[model samples]
Target: MNILIFFPSIDNGGPTNVVLSLLKGLNKNKNINIHAVYFWGDNDNNLDVINSCCDSIYKLDKVNLKSLYKLLAIIKEIKPDIVHSHCLVPDFFNYILSLCYSYKSVSTLHCNLDEDYINEYGFIKSHSYKFIHKYILMKINNVVSVSKSVLKAIPEVKAKTILNGIEELKTPLYKDNLDVINLLYVGRLIKRKNISFLISCITEINKIRNKKIKLTIVGDGELKSILKIKSGKNISFIDFNDNPFACGVENTFFINPSLSEGMPIAVLEALSLGLPVLLSSIPAHIEINDKMTDGVQLFDFNFESINNAIESMLIDCNNIGYRNKIKSQFQDNFSLNTMSDNYVLEYKLMLEG
Candidate 1:
């Protein structure tokens, strides 16, 4: 079978990682051919990896009217058995093209479109975003949500829940002197992410714990300037990294204080490295803790709650053996192999249906 994967771009983000993981995992299948196309991107790290994963790659320059025609032309040429897409724009075009094409179409709903658009675009514009997204999603041939939280977001559409997975590399037990506890947050520094509060909570945490807390904020966004203003030397910011297991994995704890998430890839990457995670008690994170991962702990979006959770982890830090269990749990549930196998099944079902 020939499968063509489509996405808006190949940036170093969760959606891109999903595309990469799917491509890499599916590329191993001898019976199937994997092809991929993207609108625009410049993440060289991911670009190289994507090039190596797919049998063919199409760069459409940018998302525009001309690109739409270009994409339609590619679909005509490829004549894939199934066309699977990621992200909003690609999903839209994939659905649009499906009207005139014979190939089965599938799209991965990476986040809760309603809340996500509200956070990014705000009230009025968000309505339009939500309306358009809902329409396209409903019309799409097959829909897959990265988490049950996301699946719940769109009750109108029939979507299969397949939680996002990550590429796990073998990591040795790493401790950065144990004097400083590295708290990591990977992904965009957006308002809804509530990262500013995370930085402030570290202050209260440091005051209580004997060890100082260091926060390494990864990814860039509009909130970058605000986060810089709010943070001191203890908090350092890095541009977007494909890696979330920065600093030292053993001493580091991944903390995401987002108001929402849809199976965040960074959290999975950190867990793969056996880094304990303290996530905001959002539905998505709660779903992960309750059903998916054993190592994740949820904290309410408050200083007391976050500080207490940090203190508990710090107290239990010396019991390094548990980190291995976290890594093992990751392999069991959120590994790329498991996700790919599920997607392969879904692809077959889409064809059969």
Candidate 2:
């Protein structure tokens, strides 16, 4: 079977990581031929990693009518059995291809489209994009969601929830003899992530407790500079690192106060590395917390709730037994192999139908 995966780029962030993981997983199947096409962004370090997994890779110059025609030409030439898309541009392009071709198409909804649009372009423009997005989603043959929250948000279209997965690290790292509770936030420093709320909570945590906590913010984005200026002495900002599991190992807890998410891969990596999580009560985070009851704690996206969650965590920061249990559960259920198997089954069923 020939499978072509499409994405805007494999530069960075959760969605890119998801596609990369899927590539790594699917490549293990000898019966499948893997091909990938990406349209935008420079060939960063990850491009090499992507190249290693696929039989062939295609990169288009841009996303325009000319580029679309070029992509359609390539699809006609390859005649892949399935075209799986990770984001909007690729999904739209694939949908158009489906209209003129005979290949099965699948799209993974990685975020809440309405929330993403409103955040990026405000209320008025968001409505127009939402309409366009829904139209394309309806046209696509199969839709997969990274989290149930994302699936529920798109009520107009039917989608299956395939929880994102990660490879488990062989040797988990731990911060030994830590004087303070080490907290970590690993993802884009963006408005949807609510980095500002995390900074404020850290500030409050430091002021109220005798055993003061420290937070290391990993990953860079548009809000990085502004967040650095607003952050308290207790917080430290770092650029995006390719290995979040390595960074997470030295921390006591993984915290994400994001306003919205689609089963964040960073949180999964953190849990895989045996770190307990303190997350906001967004539907995605809540869903994770529900599955691993002992391993995660949830709070509202406000100061009061975040402050309370931090205080609760500080009381038992050294719960090694609980952390280990969470890690075991995550390994059994959310491994890369499990996710890849599900996708392969889905691909077969789609083709058979």
Cα-based TM-score, every candidate? 0.94, 0.94
lDDT by residue (241-332, candidate 2, tens digit) is 66654654454788988888888998888888777789999899988877785668889867778777866766645575876787788977
The TM-score measured for candidate 2 stands at 0.94
Q: Per-prediction RMSD in angstroms?
A: 1.9, 1.9
> Please, what are the lDDT tens digits per residue for candidate 1 over residues 4-72?
999988877778888889888898888888889998878888888888878889999667888889988
Q: Count clashing residue pairs in model 1.
A: 0
Candidate 2 at 228: error in angstroms?
1.2
Instruction: Candidate 1: give its CA RMSD in angstroms.
Output: 1.9
Off by over 4 Å in 2: 170-177, 245-251, 314-320
Worst 10 residues of 2 by lDDT: 242-251
Clashing pairs in 1: none
What's the TM for model 1?
0.94
